[model samples]
Target chain A: MKKGKWGLIIFGLVIFIVGVTFPVWYGAGTSAPAPVLDMDTPVIKSMPNKKCVEDTAFIRAHHMKLLDAWRDEAVRDGHREYTAKDGRRFEKSLTGTCLQCHSNKSAFCDRCHNYVGAKPSCFSCHIVPEEVKK
Target chain B: MKLLLPIIALFVVALLAACFAWAEAVSLLTILAYTSFLIFAAGFVYRMMKWAKSPVPFRIPTTCGQEKSLPWIKTHPLENPANAWGAIGRMAGEILLFRSLFRNADVKMIGGRPVYGSAKWLWFFGLMFHGSLLLVALRHLRFFTEPILPFVNGLSALDGFFEIGVPALYLSDAALLAGLTFLFFRRVVLPQVRYISLFTDYFALLLIAAIAMTGLLMRHVYPVDLSAVKTMVAGWLVFAPVVPANAGVMLYLHLGFVFVLLAWLPWSKLIHMGGIFLSPTRNLINNNRSVRHLNPWNPAVKVHTYEEYEDEFRDKMKAAGLPVEKE
Candidate 1:
């Protein structure tokens, strides 16, 4: 038990030393770079200039319709139809097929959103379809 | 059987990690880190294959509500799921909310009388730890991508809502550290838990703690050049590995710790993340009686019918003056 305690103490000390020395070593030798952006320059565009969502309900309805269409397509493609105990037959899609039609992600949404500085992280996991012609 | 091999591999990895730490050579550390990852990947695939081959003769999903029975009896279909939809709903709840664990209880002897109490502490800690870690991971997206996302910025704002530090400390980081500490201490201090605890459990907790601690130290105590770190990470992500010459040793240690954690994940109990979906109790609904569940993987076999067995015994039954099927 004593040995174990001492081992933990030593490990903690090593980590602490490493933590303390790292910045001193890295920062000391390196020359500081000039600030990339000017303070006076607008960091982001005004939100009023962005494409407005007039009706969220309309958007949701359209989204649901698209979802239903995709679901139907998935079933038509010989995907295994699972009959739920509730008597609903549904087929799961592996990758969302909406990207087939809506291929150029940036053109579809990113253009205006990027201009408005409203970038979303969805693209991190998802890739824009490169093959689809604009 | 495959699990035993990873345990052995972990020991070999620990040795290598120790050696790299001592030597402090970038090449040696990189080799150690990537090699560990390769071993982990191979082991994961092998283990998954073994699982896929394993025979499950029963539909044994754990149900919390009334089973489907007589027509007069009311069935709690959603909770005790007699069908796939209900099962899916239950699975979603289990996965998202840890529904089963939320309902867990701890038993204790109170003055020689057995008592059960809510074990919500585990659920609370688990939720906080997982949720905060996820948020932290999302917040890290800025480092990997060329242009930072608005959602990442929004999430960063939300995490640093308290605005406690000079650079505005992320609340998720504090929550994550606290949650991990609680979990680690729970394993060590709790008598029953401690008894069941293996070195692997302690090792995993320690490793995560180390990772979190290093990250905190890097951010607060030893701030690295964010742009440089981002460039290095982005390069790695794009398959163009750049070992920046002046990248802080602390960053290397942090990355090393992360790689170690990733390698350990598949082999350790952390595989529970994947295993939860595979768990018979959580995934399966209690509808065995209602539905004829034929084991799809069961091999076809010839069977002797009751009539055939009775036919052979009929002559012996007549000699003994017993009722015979023929008579």
Candidate 2:
């Protein structure tokens, strides 16, 4: 076998050995805790409550109107012709334009969501614009 | 040829995992977590560097449209992009829609006659597999963050739209497993694919399967304290890195397997995810005639001019009655 193949084999072996030995090093034991469902506790909920507003239809209509306004703004800002891979042209919308208002995510979204029961995963991978503190 | 070893490795790991139940032992869980983390961290970095250093000697972009020549011909600019912007657009379509795979065809011999069939199954399966996996990954975000996002809740609701179980059944967990199984079976059972299958390929599929299996086991069989697990994950995310004492062994094994997969990603065939962008065939335009592609890395070299060559071979040419530049 080539040296490279041998190296790979050795590496795989090392990984396998480590995986096997890990359980040995750390004792295998389980401790089950009582399940608690506390609704009032504000730990770290991150999702916005779509149910907070009474009228869904009104909210959707407002959202659409906001989107139309955003589309017009995008067009005026020279971001009108959004061409896709299938040679299709689309006009860009600004309604769900995350970067615009939520430039400071924790400030804009988190404070409200934390008050309710929503905790989103956006903070996990992305840096909250507010957290940068520049 | 190297396919046998990974299978053996997988079986060995699974057997070991079965032998050491995390619920029964905490030390084992810690060992597994730390070991897997180390392997994952070291392995991933090594693989990425190796890929980044690999040499590409030719421009081999796969094109499906007309070349950008003779203005009247009308090039399919997006499909076969001639510039960076067009390439980006094409890449986005490919990544998001699997456009090429969507246009895939299957050929078979039916009663001695060659038949071409629209093979949408591959595309459908690919979409389902990837989409489901994305949902599953996104769903996992609930376990890693503090207060769960409403989008995640909504996504979970949408995923378990049928609402078959008490906590709600996630279609992705089942679909991902089934899709992976199908893909794995295709590699092993199909004579054509089996012949070309490498150990690493099988290893990747098995590792993913193990992760999914462990995750499912934790949810249904063992019933882990997800709140604690989430807290632990959140700590890790926030750079605090708190190892939860209450977290189950299955979770460790699952996390270990996931870490191994991540570490293996940059080095293995999985790098194709990133390499697709670097792929000359996928990204480059077939415009050899329209534009000169001088290798950016090419060094300035002294050239042997025709005059110098003739001067060197003048005597030999004269002796042989051959025409020479000097003569």
For all predicted structures, in order, the TM-scores are 0.62, 0.61
In model 1, how large is the Cα lDDT of residue B71?
86
lDDT of 2 by residue, B1-327 (tens): 466788788767765665555444545545555565566556654554454456544557677788688878998878778776787788778877888888888889999999998877667777777778889988765554334556776787677776544234578988999888888887888798898988888998888888899988876555554445654544444434455645556776776677567657756887565445445566555567766667657899889998988888889889999987666
Using alpha carbons, what is the TM-score of model 2? 0.61
Model 1, position A77: C-alpha lDDT score: 65
Top of the candidates by TM-score: 1
Q: Least lDDT summed over 10 consecutive residues: which range in candidate 1 chain B?
A: B1-10
In order, the first chain's TM-score in every candidate is 0.29, 0.28
lDDT of 2 at A60: 21
| Per-residue C-alpha lDDT of model 1 across residues A1-134, encoded as one tens digit per residue | 11143353346345634542333343443333212321121211333342212232332223333333445555676554544344654444323433443444555545433322233334555566563333
Q: Assign candidate 2 its CAPRI class.
A: incorrect
Number of colliding residue pairs in each model: 3, 31
Give the Å shift of residue B158 in candidate 2.
1.9
